[model samples]
Each structure stands twice: as structure tokens, then as C-alpha cells.
Target: MTQQGGTWPDDSETVPLDSGSAPASFVPKSTARRAQSTRPMPQRVGAGAQSYPDTSQFPAQPVSASAQGGAYSNGAQYRQYQQNRQYPQYQQYPQNPQYQQNQQYSNGWQYQQYPQYQQVPAAAPAVAAAPKRTHTRKSPKHGFLALLMWLATAGIVCIMAIREIPFGIDGSRWVPLIAGFVPWLAIASALFLLLSLLWHRRLLAVVSLVCLIFQVVWHIGFFVPTTSLSDEAKQAVTQTDANGLPISTDKYARIMTFNTTTGKADVNAIINEVREQHVEVLCLQEMTEGFVQRLEAAGIDNVLPYHIVAELHHGDNGGCNGIWSLSPMQNVSGDLVEVDASRVAAATITLGDSQVRFVSVHPSSPTRGNQGIWGEGLSSLSSLKEYDHTYVLMGDFNATWDHANFRNILGSRFVDSSQQSGGGFHMTYPANSKIPPLIEIDHIVHDKGVVVGDMQTVELAGSDHRALLATLEAQ
Candidate 1:
């Protein structure tokens, strides 16, 4: 056996722990040169020279300071390999920051792991996948919604802007009639504009915004005027009589105008309501001979003693209008004015030295293709304005403020009693039917000085038409 520092009998070497070296025979002089050429070799003990390399114990080698330049001693390197067995030994070949962190050993030894025999192929350099292009596109749903909103905009604009453009046919006039509600259509368009903006539809928003502004400017009056009377007339509504009491319609006079549906009314109910409600003047439409007898039998004359009945078109739906008064009618005249297939009655009643003229006007039903005659009824009634007394024309005019023809014909000479008196839009006519009146076809049109303090609709039995009672005071 070899003793420490002893030369073998064959003149072999001995281990010297202080002299920094690896086993001289196991590692070639070339490896030693390479290790020393890359770094300052660390302190190590050289193994004694042997014929064959030891299988169990690796040769001790110099410790290198930097892993980039050198490696650990062979024994320490085996230990590092055992510890990092999960990773490949070629850690430092493609040197990077990640390799430095992963190749560090717990024992403070650091080394590269390039394989000795493996040769890296020099193929074409890898081409990193071009970064996938990303793009933002609007959803198809967004486009569809924008389209729908634009249709809504076009529809509203067509109704409002093109309605009044005269169509060649007579039936086409219904377009303007229906388009009278453009105010409502414009409001809906404005709502759609808001919805379009919320959904981020840029094109739809711009288009709808433009249409909404135009319509809003065109039909700016969104709400009903609280008072249609002039500033002076409105102030006169608060005036007091000479007696210092609030000179109101209820003080002395209340007038009622009604289309009794060809006198299919409860006459007893009418007479009783007149007496209880203190209705001084009553204008009735569609009164036939049998209807007058029934009204007389029910004692309507007991409540209103004086009356002027116009039987011009008696027996027809447009026939038999009467103006009945509680006071004796001074200038009672049923021939106030005449229109074919229509009836108009007028009378003057004395009220505290003031004679108030009342007229019963029944325009032909605009339905049944008689809109022309219906217009004529309103035209003939316009003559009542020439009366010397304060004029009160009331009955079933068969027209609402929605009727542009009625409003145009009346012009500035009349005020709608319901609108002027704050009665609002009360629906009358077509009463006693399953679906009650949804429109105000009956109205009271009066001259300026006649103040409508109150207007109400009364439902009566056996009559398709309801009654309108408008209380009045002279301003």
C-alpha cells in the first residue's frame, strides 16, 4: 500500500494537500491549462499519481471564482450535478440572466454546464412568431342597433316635416290631420336620440340629434298654455262686480251645450240637472218633434221658460237645435244663420241690464264623408260674432283643436271655452257606448269678453253623445 507522501516502489507521485492541483493523471495537462487560462485557480490538494483513474472519488480540482470563466472541482461538480439533476448541463451555452440564477449551487460554487461532446447545430436563426396583430372592431349588434334608430328618426321626420305638404287626393288630407300630433312624434325622437348615444352608436347619435333639434325648434310648445286669454282678460277673470263680490260664472249664469244624440236623452234627468245645477241657458242639438215632446213632458220648460228652436233640418241628425233660457229671450231668433243639413238657434237674455246672446250650433257630422258640410256649419256659425250683444256660441261643433280646418276657419275671432277656462282636454261625445269618448268633438266657442270660468262634461243615458256645460261671466 502507498503511504502518505511516499513514492511508490515504481517511483510514483504522492498527494500534497497545500499545492493547488487536480489529480495529474486523471485530468489531462490540457484541462489543467484550460482551467488556469480562464481564471485564477482556487486552492486544492492534488491526488497521488495512480495507474488508473479512481472510480469512486473524483480528482480534486481548483475552485474558480466566476462561473462564466471556470467550473467547480470535479467532486464538488458531481455534488452540484446530483443536486441539480432536474436540469440539463448546458445551462451557460446560451448565456443569459435566467441561466445564472438557475445554475447557482447552494454551496456557493457556480459553474457553466456546457456538454463536452455535443455540438450545437448552426441552422438558420429562429424567427420569433410575429406578434399577433390586434385590432378593435365594432360589433355587428352595434351596427344593427344604429340602423334601427336611424329608421325611427326617418319615420318621425317624415311625419312632422312632410305632413303638411299638400297631397293631390282628398283622402290624403288625413295625413295632415294625423300629423297634427307631430309634437308627440318629435318628443319620441328626442328619447331615441338619448338611447342611441347611450349605446355608443356614433352615426345614429348624430343623425337623431340633428332631427331632434329641428323638430324641437319647429314644435317648441310642448305643454299646454295655462291660459289662452290675453294678459288683460286673464286679469279681468279676477275682477269683482259692483257689489264687491267675486264676479264669477256661478254668481248668476251657467250655460250648457249638448248633442243629445237625436234626443235619445233622459229628459227627466236633463230637467232635474238643469234645475239643480242652476243652468240658466241650454243649447241642445239633434232635437226632433218627439224629443221636444219628451223634453216638455219632463218639464224642461219649467226650468227654462224661454227658448228659440231651429227646425231647419228637423228629422235629420244635423237637425233641431234650440237655445233655452231661464229668463225670457228678448231677441229670440232661430233664423240667426242657416247652413244646408244644419241647424242654428240664437236668443238674447237680459242679465242685470246686460243682454247676452246665446247660439245653438250643430255642425254636420264630419264622419260619413260630410266633412265639407261640417265645415260649412262652422262657417255659418261665424256670423254670430256680428251680434250687438256679447256672443256665446255653444253646442256640438263636432271639432276639436286638433282639427286644423276648424281652428283656421274660426281664426282669432273665437276662444275655445275648455282651453281658455282651464278645462284642459276633456273628452265629450260618444257617451253611453262601450268605449266612452276618447275625443272632444263638442266644444263652446265664444267672443273675447265672454269668460269661461268652468267647463264640464255630463254623461246622460240613452244618448251616445255626452253634454258640455260651460259656466260663463262677462269680463
Candidate 2:
């Protein structure tokens, strides 16, 4: 057989060879191409595959070794084809020119080379945070309570000021009347001060404190002793007079003054007090003829035989005044106080070698339409200071120490026996009444030269005024 194109011709011709060799088989080239087409195509898988042509359009099928030639018969040509079908070497992708250089983007999506953001640690869970607390508003009641406390404090301060300064504003009668209740007012101010502190009111507390301080400084002396005195010295009686009454060679005398409520007082109570206290001089206001008769019948004369009673007219009511003394007494009613003589009974008595003029005074009360008369009567007593003798003025003046008019009557020469004795406050008026006595309208006032001791008050039935007793000695 002849060879053409390096392939054996398919003419069914046979070539003689050496004896004893078997016949060899050959696969035609067209059949070999059809077999190769049915095999699976190998696909390249990365950027390197872009340069190769795709062979996926060919259908795949399985081929057996018998259908194709055995592998060793065409191994050299098959290895040459494998070497030609190798995929292109892998290459890196090309970068876009726009992305190569830094540029700003209008759409806010440009790939900019920003500075590296610091890596933040993971946050703890929200459950780890503390919860918030809600607050409630204050009620209006608290504000209203504070307001009432402030108003009370203000009122207390005003009252204390009025009592202390004694402005006597508008010439109003209420000025003197309000002054009488200053002690109670001071107590109210203290209560207000405590309330202000509890309520946390700064202004109210300050005002209350100031007012309380003023009251304590001004009135504390009334309750606390200003002078010290021994019990024996206060009650010392050096001698007895011929009338069996107590007297002292040092010119000491025990005296008492009482208003009998228009002769309604129990005469036995007054007599017993005078006897027990050994009072040398007893002055009486609102004296009546019937009261004088009752006192005489009660044997008041046995203890104090000397007496000078103002003559009472038939219609005199209870305007008369009288004085009874253990020692001899001379009437000085006209010589001592000529004004309101009927209401003021004056007498001079000898104590040891000294002469003491005693006056039982009853001033018109400061009732409505009577303030003028009351003032005149209190002013009239000021003339007593002009006398050279030691004077002891006692009885119901219808005025308290708080009254500006009463203090003026005291002047510089005279002082209240209660105050001079350091006996503190002794309220003596409105006795034997539903309400206890709240003011010291009955007082014993003497010259400053007189040494006063052991001032006291006694309550007697049926009398509106208490009996004020004081021990006096001439200096």
C-alpha cells in the first residue's frame, strides 16, 4: 500500500509482511475528530480564560478505548495537542484611570483614600445603664401654710413694737389698752418664732427673733429679781408702838392699800389680813359710810384706832377715799392733793422721828368718755412729789405700769413698791371675777428715798381690786 499525507489509505488493500505477525488496526482521522468532539471540553476558570475561545456549544458524550485507537498508538500527536491547548498565563486585572488618582465625587460615593478610622471597641449592652428617677412637684398647701405663718409673725412684731415704743399713735385709747397685754404678746411672739423656724421661713424667723429679744430685754426684769433681799430684813419689825402695832426705830412701816369694790369687799378678810400682816397704815379707795360702819363694827379700830375718812354725800356712790393708821394721823387732804379731793384721801403720820404722808388714790378709769378725767386725776398726783416729806401713794389708780400716763406720774422721784422691792410683776385688779386679774391697776408708789421690801397682793372676796401690801422705810 502506498502512503499519502502520513496516513494509510483506506482502499481495503493488504500488504505482505514477514510470516508469523498479526494484523494491526488503524483509526481514520475523520473518525478520530468525531470522537474528540464528543468528549467534555475543559473550561478555564479565572481572568486568564478571557483570552480563550469557548467550546461549550459542542455536545458531550463518553468514548470507549475500543472505539478510539489505544492510547499508545497516537501518544506523540496527543501530547502535542495537549501542549498547544494550555491556558494563557494568569494576568492581573487592569485598574480604571479615574480610580487611580484621588478625586472628590458629587454623588458622595467616590472611593477616596480617607484616613484610617480608629477601631472602636464593642459597646456594653444598654441594660448596664442606671435608670432615671422622676420627681414630684410641691403642693399649694405648703405655700399657703408658709404665708399664714409669715403673717402671724408680722402681726406679733407690730404688737411688740407698739408695746415697747409707746407711740400712742392717733391718741387712740387702744394704744394704752394694747400695752396692757404686752406680757401675753411677748409669749405669742415666742410661739411665732418657733413656728417660723419649723416652717423654714427666713424673714419670718428673723423678725420674730428680733421681737422676742426686745421683749425679753425690756420685760424680763419684771419676773426676775433685780435686787436681793433677805427674808428677815424684809419682815423685820424693830419695836412695837403703844397701840400694840408693829413699828421700827429705823422708821420702818408695813402698809397696805385696797379698793373695796364700792363697799362690797369682805370686811373680815381685810381686817384679818391687816392684823396678820401687822400693817401700820391701811389706805382704802371706793370707801362708803356703810363700809366704814362695817369696818368699825368689825373692830378695825381695835387694831388701827386712827382714821381719816372723806365725808361721803348721800348720792356719792363709791367715790370717797379713807385712811386708817396704827399711829396718830392728821388729815392732809386739802393740803396735799386739792384736785379730786373726794377720791384722794391724804394723811400725815409719824414713823419714829420721820413723817410719812400717805394718800389713798382712786383715779377715774379710762372707760369711754372718761379718759380725760383719768388723765387729769393721774396728773394731779404728780404734785405730791413737791412735798418735803416721804409720801406713800397707794390704791386703785385704774392704770398699769404699761400706761404712759402712769409712768409719767411716777416721774423720777417715785417708783412702784413692787418694782423697788424686786417683787416682779403683781397683777392686782378685777379680783373675785370670772376672769382672773390680768393687770396691775392697784399699786403702791412711794418716793425713791423710801426703802421698799416684801411687796405682795392678797385676794379678798367681793372686791374687784386686790389688796397690795408693801413694807416701807424712810432713808
Candidate 3:
């Protein structure tokens, strides 16, 4: 190999090189002699050996003859040399079990074996289940319907309580006038309570239940039977004849009371009803002179022969009253009551050996600013309870059991025939109007000694009120 201009020889040159005599420019002048004697020259092992620069000055490293196809021509010697040339720091680490086997490179380079990896199976795709369906009841308009029902029930209960106040204390004619419809109010309260429950309103249902309970407790008497019959009255009712028919008894009497509606009620119907029912006593209110003539023409005298009629006073407003009896009647009085004399007629009727005082009653209605006169008329009848006679009072009292004034007339001595017979809610007023009768102003009232077997109201044509009929037995 030749050096030109201080440059080293070419690596492709195949010449015996001496490392001891290197270029003077690359080696320092001071250490040149010492380096030459101590460092050995790198020698080519074969003809195919690569020419490399001598690294003897660093340290003598064993050469791999396999790198140049020298002593280890089959690669065994080169692999042994590589295994022995491991670094001291890395020698403490054990060889990986996977690398225990040797691997040959394409260029004859041996290396540690690497473990083959197996692919892991992918996870199954996630799946979700469908949700379950459930049925739910929908609330009625979010309790709005129940709220309305509760309000209605509450209003009815409140109105009924207000209307029950006596006319004398409250001084409201309208309140007392509508008092007869209290039974309907009680019914409506119960109906609203049921509706509130159906609508699923918790608060409204509770309130409506309370209102229903109050109304039922307050007005239960009107629906339930309260009358108790005496022993003599029971015997008279249960007594039968040999032919398996009820025997006619003088102790029993069929009484009917009607308001003629200022002579507008059908006279023929009234006569037919008295004849068919075998009425013993017939009391008539708003009895005009012309109405009496019509009754006579309709054969009312044949049914009830004995009679007493009151004369209508000025501004009476069809207040004239009359009474007719099948039996003989005497000791008649028209001025016994303290109110207008024309409004009431009283007489004594002979029933077998016993005598019964009968009165036809007609009071001024609390309409058209006649509240004061109406109250006075009802109040005057309170005196009748003080009398010793067993009285039978029947006609248009223009009041109901709800009226404090009318109840005062009863005064523990008299009982209404409808109540005595357990006839519930016998509405008899406004019978022939556009609206069905809502109040019972006409009634048959008798002394406590009398027992009522049956009581009912009959529809009368051409009249605003129905006729009340009662079967009474004297105890």
C-alpha cells in the first residue's frame, strides 16, 4: 500500500500493512516510538480479509476470523468468540430462556432467539337487552277534574248549612225558601265525593269525603225512618176482616191536602182522587169562591159532605183555606190562629165516639216582599200545639221541615205525615213548572197521638204544587 501527500492507503488495497509505521500526521510525535514498540500490528488473516486500521493502541481485542472467512470458516468459532466477549456488567443477567436457542442471520451473524407471540382472540361484541314495558294509569287532567268535584261538594255542603238557618234569625227569605231543597244538596254532595275518588286527586278526595260525612250526618233524619207507631194504632192497621181484607175502622182516616193554585188546579182530578182514595178529610188552600163551586160541580160533596171555608181578605194572594170531612164536623173556628184569619180554617170532626180537631192551613209565602207576613203566618201556628185537642192540620204551609218556623209549629206534639210514614223526600211544590218540584211546601201535619200508615204526593194538573195524601190512625 502507498501513502500519498500524508493520506492513508485505500481500504480496497490487498497489501501486508504495518500498524507500527502509521502516518506521522495522525500520530503525535512525542508518543510515536512508545506506541510502536508496545502495539502489535494488525495482520490480515486470509486473502478475503477486510483491510481495517489498527486499534492496538486502545487495547488488544480478539478479532473474529469469521468476519473475514479465516480460522472460523463455518461460523462456530466466531459464535464462541462472541459468547465469551460479553460485557462484565451485563454478564450477571441470566440469558432469556427464549434466547437459549441461537438464530443465524443472512450475513452469517448469530443472535439471541426471540419468542414468537400468539394473537389473542378479540372480545365478543357487547349486546344490550331491550327494556320492559309497563302500563300506568294516567291522572285525570292532573287532578283538575277532582278539584272541580271537591269544590262542588264543598259548595253544596256550605250552601245547605247556610239555608238551614231560621228565617227569624237570618232574616233572609231566599235562604228559608230554598231550604226545602236541602235533601238534593245532600245527594249532590255524595255524588261529588264519588267523582273525586274516581279522578285520583288525593287532597280533593279527602276533602270531599269529609263534606259527604258531614252532610250525611246532618241530613240523615230526612232519609231514615223516625216515626214510631202506638200500640192502638198498630192494632188498627194490622186488624183484618173474615174475608182476608182489611176492615174499615173509624180510628183510621185518609186525609188529603192540596193548594188549588188560585183555582187553576184540575177540579175533576181532585174529585176523582178523593173518591178513589176514600178520603175522610180534604183540606184545600187558595180556595176561591169559584173554586168551591167547581168542587161542588165535580161531586166533592159526595166524597166529603161536611165542610168549612174561609173568606179571602184583601191582599191575601189566594190565601183562603177550607176543610171538608166525611164525618160530621162542628165547633168550627176560623180565628183561632193569631195570623190573618182568612188563611186558616179549623173544625172538630166526629170519628166514631172520638173527636179530632182539623185545620186547613195556608200561610203567606216568603215571596214578593211578604217575608214578614210569611213568618208571622208560620209563627201563629205554634199556638195550636198548646191546645188539648188532638189536631189534624193539613194544607199549603209554604214551609218544610227544614224551616225553623215550621218545626216550631210541630213543637214535639205534632209530626209531619210524610215523616211518620217514612216517606223520604216528598217534593210537592212547583209540580207543573218547567222544572220538577224541588221543595215540599204542602204537607199533612197531625198530633203525635195519630199514626201515619202511608204518605205520598200526587201530581195535580194545572197546579204548581202536588197534593199530599196521608192515611192516619188515631191512637
TM-score of 1: 0.62
Model 1 misplacement above 4 A: 1-252, 312-315
Instruction: Judging by lDDT against the true structure, name the best candidate.
Output: 3
Q: Candidate 3, which segments miss by more than 4 Å at Cα?
A: 1-142, 163-167, 228-249
lDDT of 3 at 25: 29
lDDT of 2 at 282: 93
What is the lDDT, from 0 to 100, of the residue 185 in candidate 2? 62
TM-scores, all models, native as reference: 0.62, 0.66, 0.66
Model 2 residue 376 lDDT score: 72
lDDT ranking, high to low = 3, 2, 1
Candidate 2 vs candidate 3, lDDT winner: 3
Model 3 TM-score, 2 decimals: 0.66
1 versus 2: better TM-score goes to: 2
lDDT of 2 by residue, 273-351 (tens): 9888888899987877788889899999888888888766543326588898888876466224644434567888887
Q: Write model 3 residue lDDT over 1-475, tens digit each, in one string.
A: 2345785444343332233333212322223332334344445598856443333324322222233322221234334444434422222324634332321221123432221211223448888978889756767584676666756766676676765565476346576666766667756766666665666556766766776686677556556767755566545534545743334446776678998888888999998887666677888888778888988988877667788887677877575888888777899977568666255789998665567899988877878577878788887888887779989888888887777778878877888777556557788978877898888888878887766756778998878889988777765
